[model samples]
Target: MTWNWDQPDWPKFSYKSEALVPLEQQFLLQSGEFVGACKHMGADDQETLKIELISEEAVKTSEIEGKLLNRDSVQSSLRHQLGLGAERPGIDPAERGISEMMVDLYRNFGDSLDDATMFTWHRMLLSGDREIGAIGGYRTHAEPMQVVSGPDYKRSVHFEAPPASRMNDEMTRFIAWFNDTSPGGKTPLPPLTRAGIAHLYFVCIHPFEDGNGRIGRALAEKSLAQNLNRPSLIALAYTIERKRKDYYAALERNNKELEITAWLTYFASTILEAQRNTIARVDFFVAKAKFYETFRDQLNGRQEKVIARMFKEGIDGFKGGLSADNYITIGKTSRATATRDLQDLVEKGALTRTGELRHTRYHLSLAIQSTA
Candidate 1:
């Protein structure tokens, strides 16, 4: 049985233009909303949001490939790249490499995609790793490239990419199509939709021996950023990581077909979901700002620290709200002082008290509930 790449019309992908109309419309609207939200944020808040989003993207993208990275290390690397000042002592080379690659994509979103650019991205992706035999270039051998599952004796091959001999021509066509923006040359597809197609196409090519998936995702993000004419505003990797099973299923199901409507549809839906999540995060930040503004003058040192932690940690920051014991631990205060601080917050309307005595808990009274 031949794979899709072996078919006569192998690289020709088709989808009904009308089918994507709704998704395109929704994506534009949501993108506008997310951008608008970013504009309203104070500079500090905006910087914080950007760092958090990129950090999450870097970590989650790796997670999808079954590689776990330290979130702090990733965040620290990103912070250093963005000149935000790193709080951590040292960064792992792998973490630094991933951050550099992601930041490069974001920083150069408007530049045309080319082979040299892709080579640099691949190199950055595998910078610290000595285990992978090949890095910073295309696969040299024509070894059978199949994504399979189960034991060696009972494995199921989900997909097989074209032979390595085809990589140069295949990539040339893709890069040309990606960089083409002329109206008469080729009708430009919607940016978000184009990003989805780019992702599927690159992954199907499977040009690299390692990190094809990560590179494909990075390309998608770069395409989206170019389309929006801004830095990446949302982390699509987070949404993809959450629905990874469905994500792979979509790719596998579409691998054998000439018409990629199903894959495109799935991809569009994922973007919409990602946009909604981004909007929700923006709302939380806005609400947090408002909450702080409303009580900025009323908060004491310990109260300020605790409230900041609540916002930073979100739900996991404090389970069941802040108890007296929780406050003592977080605030580093004596029992009497913690009790007084909680009472003061309640009286000042900064927090609401529930339960009684040992069971009493203090919850932030701010109208905004964090989505974190």
Candidate 2:
């Protein structure tokens, strides 16, 4: 559909490529990258990726659960309120690939990333993945084609997908333009804001079938990389999954009316939130790093294990931090053994008690990441 901005239902950003400029695009990217880079460092890169990927998958699952209630809030909201017990088989298998592919981008294209690389990432993102269906394996082989899930599966049909025959040329154009045009020729575009627009436009193009959402998300990550000059661990997907309701609704709203201001705001807000979340995660990791650095020699295997688990799980304070009961469960010891371990930990000064009796909780006597 050739977009006619005058139409009532047309999106707010209903203009062609000629309108948006390079200066604005570059500026957005540069600003977004600065914050993103600061938020991007810390943690063993591998462990960080693993934790973040799990977090994203958890968010994805929560969003799917949210979608069952309503597609609007389900897609747009970024907070995951669901407690444990949420699961989705449709998504489980794909999580590993998402994680692996993203990390691979860091390994393979960290220095030289761009649009074609983004397309290649999307290809890896969807390829051989049953969740995304047919669009999974190949670039568009034909034009005038409708993107649909298997006929048997009545989900995800993008009638807007370009004709199969034209897909190659269309994608080529998009990739080329994506690489070269920030505001097309002389007009500048900010990198930060460009990420938001590029993301929307890519999904608007709806180049694939079942994997559009996933691919769109990956595209967002790649955009961040280009903006920041490195792959970031913020898990913007996690933030979206957390706020699944608002995410879907915002996209739907934009897709139907072509008004992207709301979606752009949503995307920007999520990017900011993802950055904040990563900062929190990094802080937690930094604390863990300090704990090990400062007291590695003082801790025993059990203490080391306990501290590792606490940081890994982001546990702050606990009453009787490691109670006999928790020791029984986590340490796999009997009440007697658990009690003995707790007493030992207390004696070692690694743990301290609150109340004299059952009310007692344990905390680190020395600061985990204390400036003092």
Candidate 3:
């Protein structure tokens, strides 16, 4: 079967966006609320949120590609890149590379898409990947670039990209199309529609020797940021990673044709969910700040340290709740001190305890107030 790129009118993507109007409206409204919430947050909290979102995207994007990244290392790298602080030394090259790419994307979201920018991102993506034949350039291999799965003897090809020979011309048109469809371009499209199409179009081309999925998602983020006139701060890759099987199926289904209404609808829903998750995260941070303010004078250094460690788990607290051992480990205190601190926290309404003795688990007691 011929791929979408093999069609006569290859790059002319079509979709019925009338049904997506409500989702687009909801996304815009939520985005405004998100921005408003961010503005009200203290400078420190805003910086923390920025780092958190970027770190999450870097980790999740890599996860979607079956690569696991250390979240803490990614955050440290991001801090270094954003000039918030010095990054931890000896970071894995993959983490550093993606963090650099994320920071660049965040800083230059409004810039026009070009070959140089794409190449720079490619170089950053495959910074230490030694297996690839081409690092910062388009694929030039003689064999067809195919997405496949299963054993080699009975491999199933999901999709096949254009030949290496067509890379230059195909990418030239793609860059022009991406730039021209921007908010300030000659033929601007709606935000979600543009972002969705940019992702599908780029991946169909599959211009890179590797890392195309990650880069395609970045393009989608860039498209949304340009349309919004600011950094989107949406956890797009995080959302996509959660339903990755569905994500691949959607892409595979639309690969044989140009019309992508189903893909657009799916992407729009994902964007909305991402916006909601972000809004929740903002609320979580705000609530955390309030919690600290209320208990600032009542808690000692060890209590504060342990609670902060729990907060690091984000909106969802510890998986099985923070055990006494967890408190001892994170707070670096003895059993007696840990017990006293735990009792004190419960008395001060900072923690809620459940079960009995060894079975007991401690949970933070903060309610995330709506930021919208």
Best by TM-score: 3
lDDT of 1 by residue, 1-372 (tens): 576677789777888868889998988888887877788888889888787788878988999999889888998889889888864777777788789988898788888789988899888888888877778878878688889999999999999998888888989888887777322226566866688788998999999998999999998888888777777667699889989999999999888876888888899889888887777777777777788888878888888888887777642346777788878888999999988888898888878988887788888776543242
By TM-score, highest first, what's the ranking?
3, 1, 2
Cα error, candidate 1, residue 360 (Å): 9.1
RMSD of 3: 2.1
Q: On residues 31-141, what C-alpha lDDT tens digit does candidate 3 reach at each position?
A: 898998898798888998899989999999999999999999999999999888998988999999999999999999999999889899999989999899999899999
**Error of model 3, residue 193, in angstroms:** 0.4
Instruction: Please report how far candidate 3 places residue 226 from its true position, in Å.
Output: 0.5
lDDT for each residue of candidate 2 in 1-372, tens digit (9 for 90 to 100): 442222465323543333334434543554465455435445454454444444554345334433222222221221121222233334332343444455555455334334456555555544455555344333454444343456655566433544455445555655655555343323334444567766776666666654556666655666666655655555576577667778767765665456455666667667766665655554455555555676768766665676555544443345336555665666665777667777777887666777666765666654432111
Candidate 2 similarity to native, TM-score: 0.62
Better of 2 and 3 by TM-score: 3
| Candidate 3: residue 130 Cα off by (Å) | 1.0
Decreasing lDDT order of the candidates: 3, 1, 2
